[model samples]
Target: MELKELLDIERQGWDALCASTGASFYGELMTDDAVMILANGMVLDRAGVVESLRDAPPWRAYEIDDPRLVDVGSDSKVLVYTGIAYRDGAEPAFRGIMSSTYVLTKAGWRLACYQQTQISQ
Candidate 1:
């Protein structure tokens, strides 16, 4: 898939997270064996992620900024970007850079890995 399309998927994933959609919906764009490295340095596998996010608090807004694509191979690509997270009646919750790896499978583009690094003021 083109970089723009991949970026759109990334944005949609962020939207889904912020909306606190059910785990099943959140898992649709991800690989069954996907993993995520949280800003707190916690590593979570697909099941861990789904479980944790199943009851996550809703966010007021989530904006991904300056996404750039890195083609890894014929079947894989990586997206690097910064993002801002907003919550109702609270200060911005997260200012961070994120990297997500997408791999083409029989089901099309699916997120294989994701990592986030918080930016301190």
Candidate 2:
């Protein structure tokens, strides 16, 4: 898949976070066995992800920089980028290296895994 297409999907996820709709958004996007490996050292399964995001605070703003799409195989791809996320009343943004792996399925392109690495700066 083209970078733009996968990039759009990534942005849609960020937009979902900004709008505080990540619960439903991810619920639909993630595959049954998907997992989000957060920078905070939490590994969440699909159900955990949905529950965690259900009442999570929204991001005030976000930026995705230097994204690169990696071709893993015919039915799977990984999108990696540096992400900056802002929170209300927070002095500094949360910066991390974010990567999302998507797999094409009968349903559509669905998230297989998502990971975040904290950036020390």
Candidate 3:
């Protein structure tokens, strides 16, 4: 896929990731080698990422804002954004800024890495 097409797919993936009430679709979008650095400094691999979502209560709601895309090359790109995640009955909503890198693979564009830092209001 072209860089522009990959970016569009990534945007769709981001929305799916944020809005996923289940882990399957989200996990499918990530590369097998993908890793995520959580706001709490925990590092999660592909399985771990899926497990985390599987173990959490469904997200009541979520929103992503200011998604800025940076082209790293013809086949690579990075997206950065801030967002809020709300879970049923959770207090203080989870607010954070995230950066995710995507790379074109034979299977299409897959998330290579993701890192998120908590934001305090």
TM, every model: 0.92, 0.95, 0.79
lDDT of 3 by residue, 60-121 (tens): 66677787878898777888778677777876478998888988788877888988999995
Q: Roughly what TM-score does model 1 have, to 2 decimal places?
A: 0.92
Model 2 is weakest, by summed lDDT over 10 consecutive residues, at 84-93
lDDT of 2 by residue, 1-121 (tens): 4688889988999999999999999999999999999988999999999999999999999899999989999999999999999999984479999999999889878999999999975
Off by over 4 Å in 2: none
* Top TM-score model: 2
TM-score sort, best first: 2, 1, 3
Model 3 steric clash total? 0
Clashes of 1: 0
In model 1, which runs have C-alpha deviations exceeding 4 angstroms? none
Say which prediction, candidate 2 or candidate 3, comes out ahead on TM-score: 2
